[model samples]
Target chain A: MGGKFSIERVNEYLWEIPAEGDMRVPARIYADRNSIDFLLEESRNKEWNALAQIRNVARLKGIQMAALAMADIHPGYGFPIGGVGAFDLEEGIVTLAGVGFDINCGVRSMVVSIPKGDIEKRKEELARELFESIPAGLGSTGSLRLNFDEIDRVLTEGALFSLKRGYGTAEDLEYIEEGGRIAGANPSNVSLHAKKRQLKQVGTLGSGNHYLEVQYVDEVFYEEAARVFGLSEGSVVISIHTGSRALGHQIGTDYQKVLRKASQRYDIPVYERELVGAPIKSQEGKDYISAVRAGINCGFANRQVIAGLVRKVFARVFSTGENDIRTVYEVGHNNLKVEKHTIDGVEKELLVHRKGATRAFGPGRREVPEKYRDVGHPVLVGGTMGTFSYILTGTAKGMKDTFGSAVHGAGRVKSRKQARKGLSGEKVIEELARKGITVMAHSNKGVSEEAPDAYKDVEQVVNIMEGAGINRRVVRLRPVICIKG
Target chain B: MNRNGHETLEHTADMGVRGWGENIETAFKEAALAMIGLMAELDRLRIKRRIKLECSEPELEDLLVEFLNRLLSQIDLEELVCVDINVITIERLGGNYCLKATAGCIKREEVKERLLVEVKAATYYGARVVLLESGIWEAVCVVDI
Candidate 1:
């Protein structure tokens, strides 16, 4: 750990580090005075620096305008958590660093017909049932045992495969972005080892910050959007936040090795080796994009399975039927999607890489699901367990500003060591119970590491997104129960 | 100041040992001793079991993660408690790398407690090993518990 890297204010909400050394473009960050100051203080003299991460991102080959960091930014291996970068399809490079280890690590929120009061009555049983129904923790295996062929279909088809398997419905596919599958995934691009890892782990929630949360719509800020989402202020909801598990990790790892070698061979200079990459249309880049999309399919299918499990748990606890529970939307966070975004008044197909960030397309964007076209894409901002989570919708202003991306969660403010030092897993659990939030975990330390206090205020992060007009707060749901793995 | 921080132990000219946090270090050190104990006593030839440990992550988080995972797996396979460690190096180039260590093994007769499950590998998902401002070397490695 060293000292703080300073920032220069570019505008009211945008800060920057000038194009330096190998940086092809300036590094920009979206933060107010408060968050910016906090980041500057927290990153003082450590190997981790969002500034450095931003700079490295700006250096990615064929980046347009600037490399952007979202409000909830935090230092990560190559790109910061809430970092975003865009590269031209003709010449821009796609780096795995921008997508992260958990490919398609995303949020899937569903609305159920159950009343809030009734949910409160059965919350205790619901929490326990959910914890058991959903396999979690390290090396936890799901009930599904898939052969390579089945895994390939699941990877290629995403949620559609689950719908075909009778786990989900065709209607669910209509509600999902990209119909729950990203095109260009070649199962052959995925390694046998990766497939082996995915065999028994499809529906399992690998530990550390991954969770299945049950929430209720606390209030609605946008009535029409709420109506469109099939959610009412008091409607009970379920949110599953997870990713491609072992399969995605392997894809990212294998591609990173290839990218690192590719960068060297191409004579591309990066601030760090982890930031190595090549153009999205290049042979190397196309292979990774294909593999990553397949991984995205894995995640979508995984969430669908988990959603089925959620319905099962709810039915077992409340004695209800599957019709009572339904998925609202499944959104990807850590991914690179090639989309047309106007840069300098010209529309170009750019590889938009969002790491620890979520897509928040504004109203009228053809990419948004039909139900949400009038308002914008629904953005799910998860809070720490035992805190209030939020459902926000994208805004038109966001399209003009941040390429329609928003913060994923209250960014982690404390390191795991610092979190563990101040809080004990047992004590954190007791505190949550005292706050009327039921919690369950396979590991004690897991609970402590994810204590609400370990992160920045969710309200503040959401407020920033809302205030910036990138996303509008639709509803806030306080978690009455949470299950951690 | 405590075992939870970095505590160094002398082993031989080439290898030594170190404990990680207070709890894991105590466990890992015990694991180190167990490995050494196995090495010391295995010359007599009793039983043999081939053990495999696997942990995943990018290169940066590998050094501390793999080191801890290797020890944890040895503990499960050998059914012994390791109490000490003499660490040689925790370095990262393209990825993570570990050089040397020394440890002690718990005698079977002295075993009074066992862990929740076998630790197959330590992953890099949330692993962080660094020396802090307070002179504490902290790591947040996850084992395949």
Candidate 2:
């Protein structure tokens, strides 16, 4: 037993909490021995813990295989960050905490024609130009000022609204998840307040953990997957991490009340406040899903706009053709989607909730793009701007073990207040510059708040997932320039 | 100790906010400040204008969340920098708890450096409103940053 929890080692890189105390299925965690020990220690000492949350998710109605936590597991409200819970279509429920407030907070990585050396030679100038070009940080507004009707189109149309409006090109949409938009988005399902929030926020890269980074491939672990993802040693890449901005958060706030009431009305057990869910068949559930889809679309649109901005900055800085900059892959970490997964030799449509976990469809899965199907689509796992990030591909074993989901980031090891203590933005900038990184930010405090030391070693977390045979690494990226919002 | 006070608690990812006062209304007001404090430097805010906010919810716990969320929307969507807050009323309207307050504020760009991290939204996770044995009213919850 690890602390008060009875955990059995399934393998070197896996642990399980047996089905007990009203749990419908066992809970599994992808972690090494050290990570497991830390999780159990947190579970024993903290009111909110990843192990307990995975157990609570397992207890939710209609949970299919098992409640799984990625190696980056950390305490989050209701559901743990890096948690994945898949539920049956008919008997299961959809939850807010499962999706989180930043409705599709995700990553979009792109490859530019210019080599890594070009970026290194002009890193500081490029950093300033990109930071000035992109609207970010607290209270920043985007270039688009949409009317009510236009905002509706963005909700329903996703990134296409901006593409038609000239934010980004059609080819940019080709590599994005769901072609950058889902079909279930209904404008009527979303409230006017949420719409108003989006009118000015459609293109903004919001503050708090969101970043626009420039990097180069520092190492390649799986050469085949790296080639499929368009990565090679010393190749320049740009990755943007943000989401639906204010609109997504407001939709979550608006739906939390509706879903909570629906949970009580439908007699679904509310194991935790944020775990409150409504039956899939209920009107409230349908509305929340539609709204979430719209929010997801907004995230796609925001990233699309920011990606376009990156292209413009490159075109100006390096004097390169804008079309030469191509999208490698874009995927959401916080999302809820309906997918058909096989369980016990039968395929069933399940609502998969990935909060701080990304969809990592295995090779040959139809969900993966045709060009990348042989190797699986790239899963962009972010790292603190000062650390090493990774690009990985899903494995066939992961498809059955954890619904083909993987970690989104290093995960925080310290609180924001704790992180900010004894840290200054100027000091952080100088520290990074000494390491050959250029840093620019909208808020100096935001830089200190996101200090690299505050996070677990991302390489270690990614190694655990790889060690478990769930994912295979594609390439390692080292930051050359980081723009914080 | 001050009769009304607020402090942001350390949470691994998001932040936990707690506010205590002699009464429930004061507690709710302080809770709003607790969240706002995370977003800006309150003392240095220009405080050039005023914002009126009202929210009604079915329970006290929800009322607190609604109040903080409404403020977050204003801060994010409307760019309001709240310097100070006062709770005017926390009355029961039939079966719902209705809250009305006005905040002394300035435009976000007025003194931009006063802004800190943006608060995404207030959540129900670990949320509670209770009267303690020490005769203090407290409201506590977590905010997604």
Instruction: Go through the candidates in order and give each one's C-alpha lDDT.
Output: 0.72, 0.89
Residues A94-115 of candidate 2: C-alpha lDDT, one tens digit per residue: 8888999999999999988787
Model 2 residue runs over 4 Å out of place are A1-3
In candidate 1 the C-alpha lDDT for residue B98 amounts to 32
Which residue segments of model 1 deviate by more than 4 Å? A1-6, A10-12, B1-49, B52-145
Error of 2 at A128 (Å): 0.3
The TM-score of predicted model 2 comes to 0.98
Query: In candidate 1, what are the lDDT values of residues A1-485, reduced to their tens digit?
Result: 42334469976677888877767888888788898887676567555566667877887788888888888887776788898888888888888778866889888888888788988887888887898889876556789989999999998899988777767667777767788988888999988877877888888876678888878877788888888888887888888988888788767756766786688777777565467787676788889899999999999999888888888887777777877887788888898898888766887778899999998888899988887899887888888878888888877677766778888888887765466677798899999899887888876676776788988888888877776667888888877778887
**Candidate 1: docking tier:** incorrect
- What is the C-alpha RMSD, rounded to one decimal, of candidate 2? 1.4
